[model samples]
Target: MNNTETPSFEEWVHYCFTQGYSDFHTEPDADHYEAHEQRRQRFVDIDPKALSEHIIRLFSNPAFLADEYTDQQIADAVWFIFGLATTYFLHLRSEVVPRNVQIRCIESVATLYTDLFDRLCDKHDVDPNKSSSKDTPLEDAVYMIWDMDCIEGAVMFPKHWPHLVDPGFRVLETILEKCRTVTCKESALHALGHIHMYHPERVEKIIDKFLASPDQPGVLREYALDAREGAVQ
Candidate 1:
């Protein structure tokens, strides 16, 4: 495509996957890689909000959630969403895209990743603590969930959308109750702490329960204590 031509949704997805923006492997030389980068920059420069909207639409497509793409491709796409939205929030501060649109985009991506992670866990019986063979699908999905939780805590928390925050709280609660991996549990706790920042009364009840329950992990208890301390300070 010429520089003057804007990439269609399909073309953009293909380009993102091929250019190492998505997790799929591509080994282009310096010139080819630079060309792809320039194209992507142009896409952003021309209309970053339009590009962002297209990405959200592409992700919302039912085919995306189906088995149409390889697991790696889906993971890559989810990670790409996180990278793009976070960078946009930091650099442009939602000037191009309306803040609400940016917030929804990030929320949708997080929800999608959470769904994908849950499916992977059920299908593979993922044990987060155990070492898996390199590049395994289960491993990738677990890592993706952890990364999503990190972003949710660090970025999404401040957006303070009640709809998203409520659902996110439920998801994190499920992770704490069902997930056995230390990393996943810790990530969930961190996310819960962030959510607590805005909805302190609601989150405080959950934290209190966790602290009082003998069945809960000690690490989780410590996290709850820390979150409470942070809240007061």
Candidate 2:
């Protein structure tokens, strides 16, 4: 892909969907790091607002299909874009993207999750509370709700813009209540902890529920315990 020319909406989605997925089982060598950096550099010139608009359009249109792509491929693409958006909003290129544009990108991510849940739960009649292989797009999307690296942004977005994160919080709560996957629930707990300072009571209530639940996974319970103490995971 050419770094100078901005990709069209379809082209952008296609590119993300096609990128080789890496599990990072071993430490990446110099060549791996260089290739990853080059992939990231390809998006430097694309306007954040435009990127977000395409994301919104891609998820909003039920008719705009990605049938050719496997669920795993689509999920991998979701991970890539979420990492890109979070990196821009919380780490690099904040000046270039602007606060409002960051908000727009966040809303796009929220929309992606919403659309995934609707398709998975409402349309396909899949149970959100049941644990699966977690290779599906919806499960993968849920795992990205929190930035485990402590660069959390979704729940903290409300620090500057209060009501903007309400929907996001609701989504996280729903995930915590209904998602049975240990890592996905852990991500939700950590994401909710980001706003513990502003809404301690609400966050505490959610964490308490998780802790009190029967047969809770050890790792997930540990995360909830940490969130109860307002510890960043």
Q: Which candidate's TM-score is highest?
A: 2
- Candidate 1 has a TM-score of 0.57
**Window of ten residues with lowest summed lDDT in model 1:** 85-94
Model 2, 26-55: lDDT tens per residue?
346786887665545555335666665665
The lDDT values for all models are 0.52, 0.56
Q: Which pairs clash in the backbone of model 1?
A: none
Writing each residue's lDDT as its tens digit, candidate 1 over 3-36 gives 7466787766665544435322355577687765
Model 2: worst 10 consecutive residues (lDDT sum): 117-126
> TM-scores, in order shown?
0.57, 0.58
lDDT of 1 at 210: 63
